[model samples]
Target: MNKLIEQQIETLVEPLVSEKGLELVNVEYVKEGAHWYLRLYIDKEGGVDMDDCTDVSHAVSEMLDTKNPIPQAYMLEVSSPGLERPLKKEEDFKRFQGSLVMVHTLSQFQGFKKFSGTLVGLINDEIVLEYENKRVAIPRDLVKKTHLLLDF
Candidate 1:
């Protein structure tokens, strides 16, 4: 159900953001405390600002209101992906190649659930990372989240 809602949202917002010359980094439908939230993480060449957020929020809000794709009540949010921007697509892996990253898998692998290391880019269908003087190839399907890690 949550996946469907997020898919519906991404389908609606991806092209809209693209048309605005921005990237829709991610979309999430999550429950926090007593509220449900639809979060849209966006980015541009120099990163997004408050005005970008507001504009996207207003545009998405209007679209959501018109389409009524979601069946439940939720708060809409638009914002940047922050320093630890997620690496979602193949291009992201290529663009951020050699950068530091942290990857979390859906289940434990190699006696660990998370790894912090230098991204070796997507090789074949795996996210290769060099950590602790060794390299590991994590199956992309097993990766629950992959984000750039900030050293500072």
Candidate 2:
């Protein structure tokens, strides 16, 4: 159900984000205690500002109100992906090449499930990471999650 809602929201907002010269990084639908939340992660070349978030929030709120796809009440939030942004799409990997990243896999690789290193980008459906003075290729399908690593 959460996945379905996320998909619907993503489909509905993709065009709107693009129209605003922004990129829709991701959408998440989740319940926290008694409340539900619909979170939208957005980005652009220079990154998002308060006005950008407010604009997207207003636009998405209007669209959701009209569509009424979600039966229950939920808080809608639109904001930037932040410094440690998630690396979700293939293009994200390519774009963030040479940046530091942290990756976790569904299963262990080289006796470890998590690794942090310099991102070498995507190659042959694998994410190459330069870690421990070596280049390690992690199969894309095996990755559970990945995000940029904040140096500070």
Candidate 3:
């Protein structure tokens, strides 16, 4: 049910987001305690500002009202993906090469499930990373989550 909602929302908002010169990073519909939250993570070449979020929210809200896809009440949030942006697609991996990243695997790799290193991009079906003084190649399928690490 949640997947269906997310797909519907994605289909409905992709065009709107593109029109605003934004990339639709991800869409999530989840329940938190007693409340349901619909979050839209958007991005651009630089970043997103309050005006961008407000515009998207207004546009999406109007579309949702007319379509009425969701039955229950939910809080809709449109915002940037932030500094620790998720690296989900192959393009993302290539684009963010040389950037610092943190990867979590579904199972232990080299006796560890988590690794932080400089992203060396994808080679074949593996994600190459420079960790410590060595290079580690992680199978794409083993990756549970991969995101950029913001160094402050």
User: Per-residue lDDT tens digits of candidate 3, residues 22-138?
Assistant: 989888899999999999999998799999999999999999999999999999999999989899878899899999999999999999999999999999889899978899999
Using all chains and alpha carbons, the TM-scores for the candidates as numbered come to 0.96, 0.93, 0.88
Worst 10 residues of 1 by lDDT: 87-96
Residue pairs in clash, model 1: none
User: Residue 81 error for model 2, in Å?
Assistant: 0.8
lDDT of 1 at 9: 90
Q: Please say which candidate is ahead in TM-score: 1 or 2.
A: 1
RMSD of each: 1.0, 1.3, 1.8
Q: How many residue pairs clash in each candidate?
A: 0, 0, 0
Off by over 4 Å in 2: none
Relative to the true structure, candidate 3 reaches a TM of 0.88
